[model samples]
Target: MLKKNTQHEKVSHRKPVVLMSMGAQERKGHDYQVMTVKYIKPLAEHAGCVPLLAPTCCGSEDIEQYLSMVDGVYLTGAGSNIDPALYGQENLTPDKQQDPNRDNFDIPLIHAALKMGLPIFAICRGMQELNVALGGDLHQKLYAEPNMLDHREDGDESVDEQYADAHQVRLVSNSWLSKLLEAEEIPVNSLHGQSIKTLGAGVQVLAHAEDGAIEAIHLPEVEQFTLGVQWHPEWKAAQNPNSIKIFAAFGDACRLQVQARS
Candidate 1:
């Protein structure tokens, strides 16, 4: 039985720590943590959850400590590709853009979260990481995969906006994702080159792209909210009601977990 807390009465008092990958970017000969912080934080707040930022790389502090401290985990998106070695696959092409620090942080954190049955919400690269962490594999390059649409499309080279409704994902009936969104199909912004190849142990496919790419994954056995989507829900959630429900459902699940533990 999980111990419950009584002091934190308000939902805002329940801080859900979000584990996000840090991107290393060099500017004026200085390394900096450049990431999409503007997008996720507000949406999390809107969902009635306090977003606690968890660093990708840390010392000695095991994930269990972080998991025990927070109500839920949000795996944010990133640009780096998962190392092929982790999945026992040969590198078709070396992705020099990979961040080893984030990889080390995410792998252990993922393992700990799964073992402890913590609620997790993953997006884009985070979704891929969750799948890989659960003994799944990735396509490595989506373009290389025959008949797949071009997923990573920004509006323009100079523009900062991603392509809106560039693709559509069909949700499986009677799936947790479908039940959460209360819909059959959802339009989403795609910005990923890698995708789930083989699902991990105990993971279920919730949605799929028109070309048969895995768009969403969920694990029902754990009785925890662990869901991953290939598209960027944070970007859509700001304006789309269904997207808002997605995050809200995740937040609610975390809240329930906290209440149960308490």
Candidate 2:
């Protein structure tokens, strides 16, 4: 359990603590990027949760304690790719980099979250982790599909330009995402190279790309808030109403979790 707010009396009220799965960068001195300051802004201001950076490459038994300390879990975009063997396939991207540490962290957290009925929000590679963790498969290279669209943006463009709306994703009618965005379709910025080829058990396709690739998914059987998006909503959560809704709903779930735990 979280320590009661021992700070200012005016701010003694405890906020829901949400764990963020940090990505490791060996090139950057093998440091973990768990302190995603930019990404945590909307989560704190809009989601109303205290975002905590979690240590990756830990034991499965440690996951229980970590989950016990937090109200929710958030998996973010990573620089490394999950091993193809995770889904019963060989490494298709032999030339690319892989992060077994990230996979080890994501897979266990996702499964434990499901068993604990904890709220979860995954983005980009995080979504792929959720799929694979739940017995789904990946397309490996979405660009290879003649009928599918490339989800990445221009590399030459500036950061803001690259993160601009890449395409429209149509939401499934009556899906949780459709209700959150209050629209049949939503414009999202894309930067993922791979996409989900098959959905996992208890997972529902919530949104799709123009070429019909899986762009978003959710745990239909889960009563807690669980959502995964192909795009990076954290890029503009405070500015985008669509992004705001996602975090806000997640925040509400975390608050409820805290309350239940208390």
Candidate 3:
């Protein structure tokens, strides 16, 4: 533990802890970007869960120790890509920044959380990570891949403008998301170039981009919540009713799990 989160300490006894992932900030001398306040705070505020930053350079015992303290896990989008070798593929480009550290940490954390039946909410790189961790594979670069939409946007646009509803995501009929949102389709902010290529075992494809990119996934066998989306909902969660609903459901599931343990 780098430092106890003072905010969480105030009311963590009442709120369920959601262990959130952060990108490995390797620049400016190495250190863990365990969790971003922008990403983690929303889970605490809107979702009604206590956010805890899970470090990326810990051993299995350290991970298991922390996993015992939290009620759920939240995996965030990262600037770096997952090392392709984990999923039996080679990187198509040498220019990509890869995170073996995060891969080593998160994959085990995800599996341990899954085994514990903890609620999980994932986004973007986290979503892809969920796939690879569960014996699935990914397309290195969708731009070079045939018959897929160029999911990347103009790099020069401000983050706000870039994430402003680029496309619509159609919900799968009779899926968990369809029942939750009760909407046929919803617009989402797209900001990634890579996408899931193969469906993972025990994973359900819950939504898709108009061009057929896998937009969302759900694991049905989990005792509690398990959902992952390719687009970012945390960017403007308060404004998006669907994002609010999703987080709320996850938070509720986490609470229920906590009550069951007690």
TM-score of each: 0.88, 0.91, 0.92
Q: Rank the candidates by lDDT, best first.
A: 3, 2, 1
Model 2 CA deviation exceeding 4 Å by range: 1-13, 28-35
Comparing 1 and 3 by TM-score, which wins? 3
lDDT agreement of model 3 with the native: 0.85
Which lDDT tens digits does candidate 3 get at residues 21-104? 656676578675656666876797678998888667654457888889999999999878999888999888569777777898
CA deviation > 4 Å runs, candidate 1: 1-17, 59-61, 154-161
With a 3 Å backbone cut-off (N, CA, C), the pairs that clash in candidate 1 are 3-261, 4-261, 4-262, 5-262
lDDT of each model, Cα atoms only? 0.75, 0.84, 0.85
Ranking under TM-score, best-scoring first? 3, 2, 1
lDDT of 1 at 195: 85
lDDT of 2 by residue, 159-198 (tens): 8998999999999998767877889998999887889998
lDDT of 1: 0.75
Regarding lDDT, does 1 or 3 come out ahead? 3
